[model samples]
Each structure stands twice: as C-alpha cells, then as structure tokens.
Target: MRILLVEDDAMIGEAISQALKDACYAVDWVRDGQSALSTVHRQRYDAMLLDLGLPHKDGLEVLRVLRAKKHSMPILIVSARDAVEDRIQGLDSGADDYILKPFEMAELLARIRVTVRRNAGIAAPTLSNGMLSLDPASREVTVDGVATLLSAREFSLLQALLIRPGAILSRVELEDRIYGWNEEVESNAVEFLIHSLRKKLGSSTIKNVRGVGWLVSKGE
Candidate 1:
C-alpha cells in the first residue's frame, strides 16, 4: 500500500521511511506541511503518517484542511506531541491513530496495517491468491503449503502484486510501490526482481502482459 509521511526532522524521517520500506510499503515523504497538503490534494494514498510540528503550515492545519476537503484516507499522527490534549485534538480533527515519537517500528507497522485494512473494510491481515498466501505482519509468503523465502525487494514487489491480483502493474507502478521515492532505481530493477520471484514461485505464478506490465491471478 502507499503511505505519505510528513515529517520535518531529517533523521527521524529517514529512519521511519526506511523502516516502512523494509515492511513492504510504498512511501512518499515530504518535509513540511505545505508540500504535504499539495500532495494529499493531488494523489491518493492508503494512509498517512503526519507529524504535528511542521514548517510553512503546521501539521494540524494540514489535517484540518484535508478533512475539510473530505479526504477520508487514514491519517496517523506520529508526532513528539504526546500530551493528552494533543492526542484528543488530533483524533477530533480526523486522525485514525496517534503514535508518539520514540515508538517501536513494529508497533508503527502494526498500526499501519490495521488502519489500511480497516479503511479497505478487510478484517484479516493475510492476503491470498489461490494457494499463495502472504502474511503482512510476518512478511512471509507460502505457496501450496510450502514456505518460500524472498528478499526484501522481492517481498515488497509480491505484496504489491498480491494486493490486487489479476490487475496489471506497470514497471513504474511496481517501482513506486517497492521502493521509497528517494531510492535510486536501476533501469531493469523491476524485471530483475520479477525474474527472481518467478524462479522461486514457478513461472506460471506471474504473467507478463506484453507491453503493459505483469499480473497474478486471484484464484488458485
């Protein structure tokens, strides 16, 4: 799923972005609230991680504007502001969850999964296509009752494909989902990962759509 991270602190933003990428999420990060507001208005994201302290415009204003404009995407306030009033205000303004700074990456990921699933009206953490099963929490994949190992990039790629089985995903789309916006992508990176995944999952598991992209079926 796609996540927009609006954090002003460079170190904390970098760390959170890396952790989210490692957990198989497509992340787009911005430093200030103005850029955050613009992006939120332009594109659709599965969820957002917003920090309260921001430049140009504070994060609360960003949240208020988004809600005013009727953007229903899940927003999780991940700020250093841990005061009770801050938490209450964030929720009252439309945040789905409030996560304080110095929080565990695992907990953040768990909250992300819950928020995304809840928004999508899905009650389970596992996504399945036929005999292929993907557990988001464990980052584990199993096909036909046999366990399989995958690299971090491969897992992210597969997760993006499995999320909407049978839908064609272009190379650019796959790259966006598998890597953070700032990561340098090789020309044939998606193809390389696809090749590796096919080798392990069997050639028929993923199909090339000629010039369009690649697809995996939703049924076993």
Candidate 2:
C-alpha cells in the first residue's frame, strides 16, 4: 500500500517514514500542508498520516479542502493535541482516526492497517485465495501452510492484486499501487515484480491477459 505522511518534525517524520517503509508501504513524506495538498492531489494513496500543526497551512484547513473536493482516502491525525475536544475536532473534521504523539508503534501500525483495509472494503485482517494466505498486519505470505517472504514492493504488488482476485488490473494501475509521487519507476518494474512473485508463489499463480493486464487466477 502507499501512504502520504505529512509531519513537520524532522525526527518524528524520519522515524515514521522508516517505520512505514519497513512495513511494506510506499510513502511520500511532506513536511507542510501545502505540499501535502499538492501531493495528494497529484498522487494516489491508500491512506494519510497528518499532523494538525503544520507550516504554510494548518492541518484542519487541509482536511477541509480534501473533504470539500470529495476525497475519501482515510486520514489519521497524529498530533500532540491530546485534549478530548481536540480528538473530537479532528474526527469531526474528517479524520478517520487520531493518534497522539508518544504513542506505541504497534498501535499506530494497527490503526493504519485498519484504516487502509476499511477503505479497501475489507472486513477481515487476512486475505487469501485458497491456500495462498496473506496477513497484512504481519506482512506474512503463506502458501500451503508454509511461510514465505516477499520484499516490500513485492508484497505491495501482491496485496493490490489480491484485493480483487480475478479482476484484471492494468500495468499502470499496478504501478500506481507500488509507487509514490516523485519516485521514478523503471520501465519493467511491474513486470519484474510479477516475475519475482511467480517464482516465489508458483508460475501459475497469476495470469496475464495479453494486451489487457494481469490478475490472480480466480479461486474455485
């Protein structure tokens, strides 16, 4: 999954970015609300981590504009604001969830997984097509009861396809799922990942529809 991270504190932002990347998310980190707005408008993200106190534009203003534009990606507020009213205000302003600073990393990750999964129309924590099961929270892929590992990008690509097994997704669509704004993609990046996944899972696991696109073979 891809996430937009808007935080001004250099240390906190770096930590959050590293953590998210380690968890298999492609993240675009911006320090101010204006940059956040620009990034969101131009790029696709599964969710956002926004801080209320921001340079250039206040975070609440960012939220208002995003909602006004009918943007529906989940937003999670991670701010120093800890008062009851602050939480209420953030939620009322269109944030899907709120986390105060000095929070546990595990809880933060859990909330992000829940928010992104909810946006994907998923009610369950694990996704599977027959014996191939993936656990987003654990970043684990298991086939036939045996555990396997996937690189962060490989995992993101698989998750995108697994979201709608049997639905053909074009190369451009898969690229968007695996990349963030401002990142340069190699011409055959998607194909490389697809090849890697096939080697790990099995050659027949995914199907390519010639000039159309790619898909996971539908489970019977």
Candidate 3:
C-alpha cells in the first residue's frame, strides 16, 4: 500500500521514509503542510503519517481541512508532541491514531497496518486466499498446512494479491504497491519476486496474462 509521510525534519523524515520502504511499503514524502494538503487531493494514499509541526500551514490545519472536506483516509499523527492534550486534539481533528516521536519503527508499521485495516473494515489480521493463509500481525505465511519463508518484498507482493485474489494488477500497479518512491526497481523486479513466490507457493498460485498483468488464482 502507498503511504503519505509528512515531516519537516530532514533527518527524521529520511529515517521514516527508509524504514517504511524497508518494510515493503510505498512511501511518498512531503516536507510541509501545504504540500501535504495538495498531495492528499491529488494522490491516492492508503494512509498518511502526519506531523503536527509544519511550514506554510500547521499540520493540524491540514487535518481539519481534510476532515472538513469529508475525506476518510486514515491519518496517524507522529510527532514529538506527546502531551495528552496534543493527542486529544489530533484525534479530535480527525487523526485515527497517534504515535510519539522516537518511536520504534516496528510499532509505527504495526499502527499503520491497524489504521489501514480499520479503514478497510477488516478486523482479522490473517488474510486468506484459497489454501494460502497470511497473518499480517505475525508476519507469517502458511500454505497447504506448511509454513513458507518469504522475503519482505515477496510477502508484500503476495499480500497485495491475496487482498483481492482474482483481481488482475498490472506490473505498474504492483510496483506502485511494492516499492517506495525512492527505491531503484530493476526491469524484472516484479517478475523475479513473482517467480520466487510461485516457486514456493505453488506454480499455479499466480497467473500472468501475456500483456495484461498478474493475478492470484481464483477460488473454485
């Protein structure tokens, strides 16, 4: 899934962006509230990581404006502002969750998953397609009663497909979901990962249409 990361601190922003990418998430980063506002209107993000302090406009104002316009994208406030009032204000302004600064990357990723799943109205952490089972909370995959070890990119690719098992996703769409804005993608990156997953999950686990794209097998 794609995430919008808004932070003005160069060091902090870079760190978060890299961490998100490492976790197999697509990230688009912006440095100011105005830019954040503009991107929200222009781009499709599964969730947003917002900071309270921002330039050209306060992040809180951005939150309020987005909520005012009735946008339902899940927003998580990640700031150094750990005060109770700050947390309350962020939630009141439409943020779905709040994470204090100096936070653990794992926790941030977990919260992002929770926020996105909550938005999707999905309560189960384990997503399944046919005989394949993936536990998002545990980051584990089991197929046909056997466990499978998948790389981060492999898992992300499978999750993207399992989320909508029979839906065909173009290479560009899968790439958009699998890599961050800054990552270098080889020409056959998706094919390579798809090969790995198919090798492990079963050859028929995924199918490719010559020029169309790829998709997980549909259940009978």
Please tell me which predicted candidate would have the highest TM-score against the true structure.
Answer: 2
Report the C-alpha lDDT of model 2 over 1-220, residue by residue, as the tens digit.
8889999999999999889888888888999999999989888888999999999999999998999899999999999999999999989989999999989888999999898778878888887777588888777888888878788888999998888888999999998888876679999999999999889988888899999999986586
lDDT of 3 by residue, 65-159 (tens): 99999999999999999889999999989999999999999899899988887887667777776678887655678987998767788888887
Report the lDDT of model 2 for residue 96: 97
Q: RMSD of candidate 2 to the true fold?
A: 1.7
Q: Would you estimate the TM-scores of all the predictions?
A: 0.87, 0.92, 0.87
Name the weakest run of 10 consecutive residues (lDDT summed) in model 3: 130-139
TM accuracy, model 2: 0.92
For candidate 1, write residues 1-220 as lDDT tens digits.
7799999999999999989877777789999999999987776687899999999999999999999989899999999888899999999999999999899999999999888778766677887777688788887788878888778888888877887888999998888776665679999999999999889988988889999999889784
RMSD of 1: 2.2
| Distance from true location, Cα of 71 in model 3, Å | 2.9
Q: Candidate 1 or 2, higher lDDT?
A: 2
lDDT of each: 0.87, 0.89, 0.87
Worst 10 residues of 1 by lDDT: 174-183
The TM-score, computed over Cα atoms with residue i paired to residue i, of candidate 1 is: 0.87
What is the overall TM-score of model 3 with all chains considered together?
A: 0.87
